[model samples]
Target: MSTKLELPIQEFTTPYPVTAREDSSIEELLDIVKNLKVRHIPIMSNGKITGIVSDRDLRIVSALSAREKFLVRADDLMTSDPVTFQGNTSIEDVILEMSEKKIGSVLVADEKGDLQGIFTVTDALDVLIEILRGRK
Candidate 1:
């Protein structure tokens, strides 16, 4: 029973994820998270990915005063230059990299460096659950 995880990540990636602009307000970010029920929002500048903000990141600043939150923007609190991988990248490699970096998600881009999608730890878990079920 070979359990090799060598498949391309595109099959499991969440394609065309919702994104935010660098200058988007913290409130806008929060709205996106709440309304869309998504955990991560890639920050874009000039149509290119610049950073990422996760639900955890937002929660960290949730304690800030209302005025302070209003003054904040996506770029102000996002993780800059988040780890990225091509959609064709192997699942094992992507998972290993995410584990090494201790990150919840990684952006997937095309060869032209355009944002393609996002693969999160939750996605990985889903993949694992599928594999385990197949083994049963």
Candidate 2:
């Protein structure tokens, strides 16, 4: 019997993920983050991705600019030029990349840079759990 390990990220990624505009207010992104229970949100502008916002970004902004909450926007705190990968990339590479970069998630885009989905640490954990179960 053989066990497969080199699975493509598309097999487990969260496709068509929720996104937000770079101009969105911190309060709005916070609401979305809480309601969706998702940490990373791809930030877009003019139908083009500009950055990614995360819970950490929001927390930093909120804590640093407590008096200027109204002045903070996604663009002000987003991680510009976030790491991205194609769906065909292997799961091992995904985890390796994230581990090397110390990031929790990466955007999934096609050759044309079209937004497809997101692959996060949670997804990686799920894959790990599946592998462990299969080994049992």
Candidate 3:
């Protein structure tokens, strides 16, 4: 019997990788988040993932004044060098990393180091339940 994780990270990931430019306004990114129902948006600059903005990061802007909010950009508040995982990575490995890091999610990138998808704790838990029930 193979003990390898049957479920791949990509299987449970959110793809098309919504992203924001480093120079983009917080309002723009906020709008993206609202309209797309995305919790995290990767900050892309020069075709690279420079940072990442999470729902929590956006809330910090909401806590500020309307005028002050304009002063903020995705780059200003996003987490730099966030934990990232590969598309082929196993769910078990990702779950372990997320648990150890106490993070809710991690960016999923492809073989060429391009942003591919996102894997969240919620996604992992859902997979866990399915696997336990022999439904995967």
- The TM-score leader among the candidates is 1
Question: What digit string (tens of lDDT, one per residue) describes model 2 on residues 9-59?
Answer: 888899988999988988999998999999999998887678999898887
Tens-place lDDT digits, model 3, residues 1-136: 7586756889899886788899889889889989989888888888877888888888877889878887887779989988888888888888888999898889898777788888887788889888999988
What would you estimate as the lDDT of candidate 2?
Answer: 0.88
Which of the two candidates, 1 or 3, achieves a greater TM-score against the reference?
Answer: 1
Ordering by TM-score: 1, 2, 3
The lDDT leader among the candidates is 1
- Give the RMSD in angstroms, all C-alphas superposed, for model 3: 2.0
Model 1 per-residue lDDT tens digits across residues 26-99: 89999999999999999999999999999999999999999999989999999999999999999989998999
Q: Residue 2 in model 3: shift from native, Å? A: 12
Reference-based TM-score, model 1: 0.93
Clash count per candidate? 0, 0, 0
Per-candidate RMSD, Å: 1.9, 2.6, 2.0
**Residue 61 in candidate 2, Cα distance off native in Å:** 1.6
Off-target runs (Cα >4 Å) in candidate 3 are 1-6
Q: Provide the TM-score for each candidate, comma-separated.
A: 0.93, 0.90, 0.89
Q: Which residue segments of model 1 deviate by more than 4 Å?
A: 1-4
lDDT score at residue 92, model 2, on the 0-100 scale:
89
